[model samples]
Target: MKLLLYPNCSNGGVTAVIRSRANADKENTYLVVFTNDRGGRHSFDDLDNVTVRIVPDFRLGAFLTYLFNEYVFDSINVFSMPKIVEQMVQRDELAVTYEFHSSNMSIVEKEISQLPLDRVASLVVPSQEMKSKLSERLPKRLLPRLQVVPNLVDEFVFNTNGRSDRLSSLEEGLIPLVWIGRLEASKGAHFVPRVLAQLPENYVAIMIVSLESDPTRFDRFLAECDSMGVAHRCHILMDLQQQTVAEFYRSAAARGGWLISTSLMESFGYAVSEAISCGLRVAAFELPVWSRFEEEPKLVQVDAGSVVQMASAVAGKVS
Candidate 1:
């Protein structure tokens, strides 16, 4: 059997899932990916069995090119694309499977509704909450096709074995706090400075590994940290290698601090789980996605706009 995998969003979870499927299956598989917003090609494309087709950002060109490629494949597996569903629904030989990872169920429902339900052989959702939500929205006949495949980081990349010496040098009474993700408004980078301003001096050493796509916005975040006098406590990691990320995890874990996920909206919260997998605890706001994990005791659910509550939550965990 063969599979044509389309991973539209270049988020880490999407890449990890496709890489897992491609590497595990003995059968022939082709990876059809879009140009990464990030400068580099996918790290996992070293697999000899997989062939990749990178499409341009132009929708019309991508649609035509992707439609042309679909003709050669026996089955289509789309991570997210409304047009792909439309194209494949018209084909007889192609079996369709879609993996839904977006936080917006309404958008997914609207897109999936256009495809012929009979052609859709399977539907994969990252979180059980997302699966349940889709089951509720989908027609009764289509509900049986849904499968819950939770999102997971590559365990090796997130391993916690390398920071023994670095962690040993921590100041006598300071906790370590880490926020790892893109430093953008959606990631709650704005709220982080507010939280830091309210915290006590020398209470914790904060490490921020932000892979910001926009330089202007990245500079703004740095400016906020500097103007607030929180720059000393935080280090903004711009070009983070996977190995360095693992070291950050191990260093923070050894120091007994928590990894904070302050994203206003996270479909599955990959960082939260990465921290958990590293044997570190998390203190995230109560997003429905966060509830899917078994760390509610450590969670501090807050209103979407509650900066004070967010600060209080961080302080509660660190102080």
Candidate 2:
């Protein structure tokens, strides 16, 4: 049996990634754990081979002690979790793979530097972009143990020709712009309304984001939309399955729409990759991490930090 641990609710990409992995693994019985920091839905609770548990108390001691008493795990894989190495600092022959999912390398470096290296079997990152970032910040001795493992985006085998009710408000002939991520400045969601404002009125925006992830930012994003006079044109949708989102992306692509991103940085751009997987063109800032999709003709990268450049990339020759 393997153990997968994370500190977030079913908020965003990470939870979905775990669910995909759990569903694919038929050989191993896994225990998937999460914390109720934000208190939302469970994506893995219904899986047959996976046992879903939540730790209400987030302290490292409380978390470990509670799990230790209940069941035994063969190996443990942790996602962006803190201070667990310290708890097992004195243990011998432990099997632990610490996976860093954060967009910030400084945070990853600080946490790894504090860990007792002997307790950790290996360290894994989601992409080469992240591994490169970690190599720059982490100590020279720790470099050899670091490995790059790209994240998995769920594949859709079927297409939905029917339109979802959430998207019914969008009329025909409008260029439906799509954005997906948490409502955070890091994810570049704040840039959506401003970019929408710069574009022509014929372009309407549809945002798929987690409202519970950042309520303050969610409210601020909406206010910015209202301030920019694009709130009426901005449609925000939440709590959607990947298949439904794929259908929406497919529909958007059919109407000559593009999946647009304004994220400042991405460890790996799951939204963009998933959009491309769904056969939609993707537009994002020209960040190093986006180079993974360079071969994809559908992905057009605009100059970073320029709202006008982003607007013009999606909508040709706009004044």
Deviation from native of the Cα of residue 226 in model 1, angstroms: 5.2
Model 1, residue 13: what's the lDDT?
46
lDDT of 2 by residue, 5-74 (tens): 7877654577877766766776888877777544335555467888777775446567676666676778
Error of 1 at 45 (Å): 5.1
lDDT of 2: 0.76
Off by over 4 Å in 1: 1-11, 20-32, 40-42, 45-49, 57-75, 105-119, 136-141, 163-175, 183-185, 203-229, 239-241, 295-319
TM-score of structure candidate 1: 0.75
Candidate 1 all-Cα RMSD: 4.3
The candidate scoring highest on TM-score is 2
The local lDDT score (0 to 100) that residue 248 gets in candidate 2 is: 82
Q: 94-167 in candidate 1: lDDT tens per residue?
A: 66787776665566877677666667889888877787788887888888899987765766566666554445
Say what the RMSD of model 2 is. 2.9
Candidate 1 residue 222 C-alpha distance from true site, Å: 4.1
State how far residue 207 of model 1 sits from its true place (Å). 6.3
